[model samples]
Target chain A: MNEKKLKSILEKIHDKNYDCMILTQFNNIRYISNYAPTSFAICLLKDDPIILTSSMDKELAEKTSEIPVEEFKSFNELKKLFEKDNFKKIAIESSISISLFRKIEGNWDLNIEDFLEKERMIKSKDEITKLEKAAGISHKSFKELNPMKKREDGFTEWELAYELGYLLRKNGAEKESFETIIATGTNSSLPHARTQNKKLQTPILMDWGCKAEGYCSDTTRTFVYSEKQEEIFDIVFEAHNKAIKSVKAGIKSCEIDKIARSIISEYGYEKNFIHSTGHSLGLDIHEIPSISKKDETILEKNMVITIEPGIYLEGNFGVRIEDTIIVGKNKAEIIGNLPYSI
Target chain B: MNEKKLKSILEKIHDKNYDCMILTQFNNIRYISNYAPTSFAICLLKDDPIILTSSMDKELAEKTSEIPVEEFKSFNELKKLFEKDNFKKIAIESSISISLFRKIEGNWDLNIEDFLEKERMIKSKDEITKLEKAAGISHKSFKELNPMKKREDGFTEWELAYELGYLLRKNGAEKESFETIIATGTNSSLPHARTQNKKLQTPILMDWGCKAEGYCSDTTRTFVYSEKQEEIFDIVFEAHNKAIKSVKAGIKSCEIDKIARSIISEYGYEKNFIHSTGHSLGLDIHEIPSISKKDETILEKNMVITIEPGIYLEGNFGVRIEDTIIVGKNKAEIIGNLPYSI
Candidate 1:
């Protein structure tokens, strides 16, 4: 399984004329090696890749890493290990810190290239299975928590978020993909508002997710009680439904954004749609090929992404609907069976 | 207050002949502009500074920022704005991604510098107050949770972490400084162990903290059961105590590390003491001038840091003690009143 993930990256590195690729992003390293480093560990993707970790991480690394693990001593020693092999010109992740890049630079020519993100853009059957399973757990937990039914329970936003979190774990999620967002009332206008201690209000915007086997699931739903809130919610729901229907292999990511944006625009609320249509999610929540007006990557089969459309009316209220989907041979397969409206 | 924070960085930028400094790290930006970006945003520090944020964030930015806020467009447009000002060079954080650096490179000489970090190393009276408050709340919450007494209860590690999190929020914390680590028995051997769902064991290790107005406080306590665990705990406690007593404004960071490390070495378990002595913390959990053997930074007044010393017996169990402190004129001032031997 690890060999299959590494094959394409090796070919890419060879084409780019680099001897090896260095990966430091935790999720990227986890993609290549089963080990998700709890601390600093360097994954050098060579013909025979190795993970160099600190003494503190050695035991965990040796236990979990699919490849050979070595205890790191110093940069000088690390440089010597590579020099003995007469290596030159390395590809590094775009996320490498300048300090790390500098320490590893003097011995060889180093350039930042994201071979892993590109390779990860196309998901395998195993990866898709994890995403689907994560989505199922998240959806089931949402149903169990039933935010709409508990709307008037006098719970603070944080309390509701805690309840949902407990549900996610009890239903078999490893952890939440991100901190749960339980923005209510006027606070929902902020696209990425932090969960507050304020009481539940007329309109509540919940954006939450859970993880399964390192894969992530993201979802959002707004419970509306007033006529004005419902009117805005319907517009977002239409944009979301139409955008998912338009998704297919060969269509550019921006096309999906355009379809979603156009629906909101037709409703004369384009300016109120604060963020991108959505983004890709797998090991990490925000991955390559964001579904935004500026992103142009073509959709491909088995690439899982989300379609979240929101309309925020600043101090009044906001409404958003989100769902994860799998890019299919011809159409998008929405991941869960949650009701659109309550 | 923000002006006081920006003065040093502006001088450093001018000394290096750079037109301005570009900051993207959320805390660094917040340190200067008082607006922490939820999504992507750029802060330009100059004679007259401004924060360039997404339209989605413009509302919040305008509300919170001490400096002027503007809508960010493409990098191409940003280049034109700087070109109009006759800017020739700029300083950036080491954290700037290779992709972002390349996008902003065509017109200006971009270099990674740590002026903000060097400046943030010393906390202000206001920052110290927040840190102290954060530590107070965290300590009070731990007392309320009382892991020692809860050891016999049928609670999972995750459950303890959740209960502690609830207590932190209820006791006036904005949120946890980081995810609470609740490692029980053998799991505690991993320095950075994740909280598990397994039932609580005899010896419980919890490293936790909470945020007070964006400043962070970190503390760790290991609840030991058997005499073997208690014996290891005393060694760690002695190391933690002596290393902290050695903290003064004039000494080097490495000296403090050496003091703790030497005591652990004397106990014939130097190899068991796995990570660093400690690290500085403020807006971010880990900051500049780490209390490690390699760090030669001279301790300075008002520098807030942690002194956490531990000994792990690989597959058996682990014992650790940590405390946040303020480097004083001639001694160290531990932030919280939490009992050491509890």
Candidate 2:
């Protein structure tokens, strides 16, 4: 439990003139209380924060939570607590479900804020360590799998995904950070293509990750074959490299996005890059400060983000090169030593 | 989709006086449109229902959706479509984020409803077949793993979990429906205990599942060792058996829960039954019409639910037995032939 982080959050609530904030997201509650609920639970962030968990979770919460814990009965009971605290202006996460919001939406000024997300943007030294370990295990497992050999063996995309998942667990990672994407041939054109049972094909785009101590690592590597595929791969590689080079403590996230987008544009594939350049990663696979056109979040030291740039040609193949990096004083440092080309 | 299902949903919307419904949940969208969005997408349920997907999903949506598809540009553009349709009342799923709800909130009467859930509660013949296949694959994989032998080899909980996952994929499962719980020894007391790196111990409690063609299957089995463990296991097994025996078309969900709870209570361990008796499983691992003390939903024919009864003794070993069952006109039919005692 980081007391400093809790104090900082309380100070932010005070600054916003909010008496308290309620967090229902599992990751958010885990971030503050060190107890991730298997089912519904809520963490009330205040001077003295308390986690109200379901009856089934009480034992685990009591054992694991850093703060005080209690059994949550109903929304009315929670509302009684707010009234007891004389909280007129309450803060709620933007991600709170509409149904939940409606249950307790009366006689109060409920402001939607990203208080926890803003705090989680910058990774601490401990968090960076976990991310590094996660990246290390992921890269190690990928090398152990020898995807090229598996492809030569005529393994299906889903088979490769399952094997990679097995390797990650064997290499001391909790699990995959997200669904392992092993898109091949024309299927690579779809950014979030589901792994198919079909045999491996040309231009394999494998975007995979693993979790270590709750932190997440994400990386993408495309194995190009044809000359046309190599051409697109080169453009994506250049974009990915420049995006990382553009990351610094004082730059806006969008500037870094521009660095990647403009590089792809220079090669006449700007519109082909459909998704954002990259996104931040931590306990959650996708986090705040997304590196997109509209985001103006300033990159700060200790912030960990992914710089993935791709060019997906419809009905053809695609190429994506991604690496998780930690923001430095003047630049970004990629987490793992995985090679760009296989 | 079954056109009949879509028509039923449309009829429900008309009956509720809702001009249209906006579905953001992936499963709901998939249920209605047959295209599950990998990222953010919405389905507008109307006479001529259309799915507005992101530009990145345009190709996939066009290929897979049963209904019409269009590229979603901005919230303002979507609002314009609603205005053009002259929609006076709008219905939204309760799970929509407050942030998204706020962006589209306006003069129209926005009502939160479970129209989709109500419709999905009753499974179709096709859905039942998918569920049966999912259960068969899951059970076959468990048998292939041979957990007793793995325990003899002193394998860790996580290793067994990974092996089960690999076997599930090998046996034709898309993926695990939820994180596999492979708790051993006293760790079994934690209903949702994460698989640990420690070697296998007494009283192994495994609750695992997998997906088959978007449908889910869940099952739990506890391997008891000591006399005390066996005693508790007997009580849980009796509760499980009786609960399944009590399951019929006309009974209430709570009645089934009471049958299970009372059996455990008769043995003076009612407080140890921490979580609900069971829950419905479909595309999602846990769904509506859960078999709990509070749920008063009637058990209808074609409704697929699990009958799991467990006794968790905190700081001691625990035992649980579960099986997915399809409610028939007269009684319940278990999905798989997995043995209760192993």
Candidate 3:
């Protein structure tokens, strides 16, 4: 995978008219070189790739990375490796911070490139298989979770989130892809509400995911109670189901988003739908070519995405139904075999 | 707390000869304005300080923030707020990304300022109270965790970390301060080893923390067995104990690091002591005035920092001991009362 990714990156560098591409983002390095450093590590992709890792990370980097790893002495030593005038144009990741950019910008013609991101958008069969395995673990864990037992015991929101994390890991995940959201009652009204220290309320919304083999899986399930809660839940379920149903090769990502939004709009709760219907997921929990209102990326086979449409009524309650889907020729195949209804 | 912090910031800004300061880093905004945003948020420090949060964050911002919150429309709107002649030099956080810096560069003269970091290094009485609460929750949760039960039942390394997270929340923490590290046995050889989906091993190194009311707590404990493990453990414990003892108001941060390093060196394992002795923790997991070889900042009263020292032998095992401490007149007050021997 490292050699394949490196070859593609080298090809991209040549095609994009750059002498070298410098990767500072840890994940980018891990994606291309398989050495994810615990401390600072940089990968300079030239004719021959080299990973510059701190002395602390040298041993691990050398052990894991496909490329040769060297202990980084200083920036001056790194600068000297390249010719002062010949290696002028260098590509940098867009996420490089100002302080780092300031330090390295004095010599090179730095250009922010989305080369890695663009390449990462399309998943290989092996990558998709890892993602499916992650989704499988998350789904299986959710089934094993006795929410009713917690409901009877009156568990706090964070406790349930934490319990779910434990289950995911127990079911063969490295860790949660992102912070598990277990917002209950009115707290769920905030789209990204922090878990409160209170006991579980009438309705609970959980947005969670887990990491397996560096791949990610994301899912959201909202437990409802009252008639009003059930009413909102039904609308969200329709949007989620239809959005997934509409996903296929050649279909625009925004079109699927519109389908979900239009369903909620027809139910007279358009404004209540706060965020996008879905987003692509891979190494990162949230990745490029999201299923938002503006995204025009054409859905292709092996493109995994989520269809999570939520209805949030501030200071009251909210409901969201989400699922991961792998784009297919006719219709996207939902990764998990779990039932949507609780 | 927000008012007091803002007043100090206002005075600092004036003293630094700046009319307004641009706060881009999220934690800095939370420190001064009392709103830790879910998405993007910015603060423009002027006579009447205001926060510009994304539309998605407006509801939460309004509910949580002490300061006035407004919708962030565009960068052009920010340009309009600043009169080019009135504010010649605008101070920005050193941590702000180069991408954001480039976007706002055309608007004004930007100067990287450690304004917030310097002020945040010395914790207030109220801030220390929150840190103490966070530390208390973490220590209590660890004590309550039964690794034997988890391991006997075939729980993975990530499962143990997740269980601790749940317990922390149950004991009244907002969330885990950062990603919990639960590396077991051979995997623990890597200082920053991420949790894997494997069963328990001989020596386990768990570094975990929890956040309470925005303040963070950090702790690391290495469970060891074998003769080699016992030997490494002895060296790490001596370094950890001596480092904590050296933390006092009048001493330099580097002196504390040397205390830790010298002990490991005396045992002929200086090269294996990979990372820093410690780092200040509050709001952010790794904060300013780091206890490292290059840092010259003097330990000040009320400064809460961690004293973590470790020894790693590749493909063998690693041992690390960590604790949070508050600098006092002649000594340091350890936050959590958990016994080192478990």
Leading candidate by DockQ: 2
Q: If both were scored by DockQ, which would come out higher, candidate 2 or candidate 3?
A: 2
Cα TM-score per model:
0.98, 0.98, 0.93
Candidate 2, after superposition: displacement of residue B44 in Å? 0.9
Ranking by TM-score: 2, 1, 3
Task: Show model 2 residue runs off by greater than 4 Å.
Answer: none
User: A192, model 3: CA deviation in Å?
Assistant: 1.1
The fnat score for candidate 3 comes to 0.59
- Tens-digit per-residue lDDT, B127-165, candidate 2: 999999999999999999999999999899999998998
Clashes of 3: 1
lDDT of each: 0.90, 0.92, 0.86
- How displaced is residue B102 in candidate 3, in Å? 2.6
Question: Every model's DockQ, to 2 decimals?
Answer: 0.66, 0.76, 0.60
Q: Give the runs in model 3 whose Cα sits over 4 Å from its true position.
A: A83-86, A146-149, B83-87, B146-156, B196-199, B223-228
> Pick by lDDT: which candidate is best?
2
**lDDT, residue B94, candidate 3:** 75
Instruction: List model 1 lDDT by residue over A126-235, tens digit each.
Output: 99999988999998998888777677678888888888888888888888999899989899898888888888886889899999999999999998989888899989
Q: What docking grade does candidate 2 earn?
A: medium
User: Any runs in candidate 1 off by more than 4 Å, and if so which?
Assistant: none
